[model samples]
Target chain A: MPEPVEIGRLTFTEAEIRRFAGAFDPQGFHVDPEAARQSPFGGLVASGWHVVCAWMGAFVRAHPSAADSPVDHPSVIAPVGVGFGLQGLEWKAPVRAGDTLVFFTQVLEARASGSRPGWSVFHRRNSARREDGVEVMAFELRHMAPDPAPGRG
Target chain B: MPDFFYEDFVVGEVKAFGSHTITEEEIVTFAREFDPQPMHTDAAAGAKSVLGGLSASGWHSCAIMMRLICDGFLLRTAGMGSPGVTENSWLAPVRPGDVLTLRRTVLEARTSKSRPEMGLVTFKFELVKADKTVAVSQTCLIMIGRRNPGARLA
Candidate 1:
């Protein structure tokens, strides 16, 4: 099994949150820092979806565009799908602007597709929390990694 | 954006429309900007990975649904916004060459006593493929203009 990768810690700047919230969300807690401070979250909070995005990046170890990334590898490739089971997703604590959070990724499994011509699954659990050790939000994402021949030996 | 008064949107109503053509380009573009996972960004890597082949990002599907809403429903109506979505689920994978249509059913509509210009409207969103496959579905809550006589214009 490939060693589980620890994507390490990253911080959320209020500006990043504002940028995402403005065009996509535009909600008071997401886009307006001053207003977010007064909300129950007690400060500017990263959008729940933003947290998921960061976690996905961490789980993969390298960015998709990295030179060594499989995406850049020779075999024909592409993702079939990504499923987020919201049943267990939790927004435990609000992630605030400037708060550093580390991401932990555990590779649950890797298997060759039995049904289709090119199919496979890379199951990963992505978790993130604050530098102060507070769990904020997280979710498990399952990504489809399709390859030419069955290669999950 | 005319306020979509409570009286305007009736429950059990279904609105169908969209311009989302599931292009590998649009899919990759969205996944790169919003998701950027290995499977989403690289086609070759995805072939080697477990999901076997290329799949569309779930968020990409949802975002496209959002854009369709803006074009068909939201822009023509005054909308406040939804508190959030609950029980959101993506039932199937969407891929390139897929064409999707949004079918929205007005589940419920009610005047908010405290908010004079708006009423809450709940909808069920379904993304159907060209082959009549239901690829994704979810529930959404939106703030819309109300037509109630007692409702004030926002």
Candidate 2:
């Protein structure tokens, strides 16, 4: 592995928000500038899932460790499942289209599956903060990553 | 495809079903296109590094779910798009040969206070495996027609 990757602060402009919203989540709070003013957020906002996706994009782009790693082209590991019953995601505030978002992700753990060889388990933890200097979203993403050394997945 | 109008939706309703499998070819294709991680691309690389073996990307799964919903239920539905989703839950790992399925519950439905011709339908979606293990879950919001087929926002 190259090194741990860290994505700096990322802000959102109204136009980018509108574009992303219009494509995947065109709705009252995302597509229309005026319509969003009436929602609980008081302005246009991005979807939490989308926010996570965006953070992933930026994080990968900014992290030299991930960028320099000998990872697969598309991706090597896919998440097997998510524990909804045990998740600790809290959308503290709506991500308005105009505000910026930032995140910090680190490799938490890597364990080879005892039941399945040639398949290891990789875990990553992401902490997202809003532009106002507040941590807004956090998640522990577990996937499959490979080990460069022998006998260690 | 039949148009699913607003009137066809009901709160507390659940739809259980399945999707296509996640194959090695698809994992590589998606990884190469967007994720490019060792686990998602090379089985050996993934096996050696962290995940132990080949895996899929989370976004790829989300995109697959979108396609499934659009084809299985949302196509030609007399409904507007969504603002977005929240509280996505992936309960288990999906692998090759795994047949993806879904179980969705209609959580809420109400006519828009301002947009008289349209109504919003909110649902909680659960993705599962053939063995009935919950793989992924999420809450989705969609707008549907009240009565008119051509009801739209201007």
* Model 2 residue A126 CA deviation in Å: 9.2
User: Model 1 over residues A30-87: C-alpha lDDT tens digits?
Assistant: 7777867664445677766567666654544443333433444323233233464333
Which sections of candidate 1 miss by over 4 Å?
A1-81, A87-153, B1-3, B48-52, B148-154
TM-score of chain A of 2: 0.69
Full-model lDDT, candidate 2: 0.61
**Candidate 2 has what TM-score?**
0.57
Score chain B of each candidate by TM-score: 0.88, 0.87
- Candidate 1, residue B12: the lDDT equals 93
lDDT of 1 at B25: 79
Give the Cα-based TM-score of candidate 1 against the true structure. Answer: 0.60
lDDT (tens digit, per residue) of candidate 1 on B1-154? 3555566788898879875777887777767765666566667655654456566777777666665666666656655545555445777778788888888899987777776666878888888888878777777677675555464434
Give lDDT tens digits, candidate 2, residues A42-120: 7777755567657655654453343333344222232232122313445556777557777777767777857646556
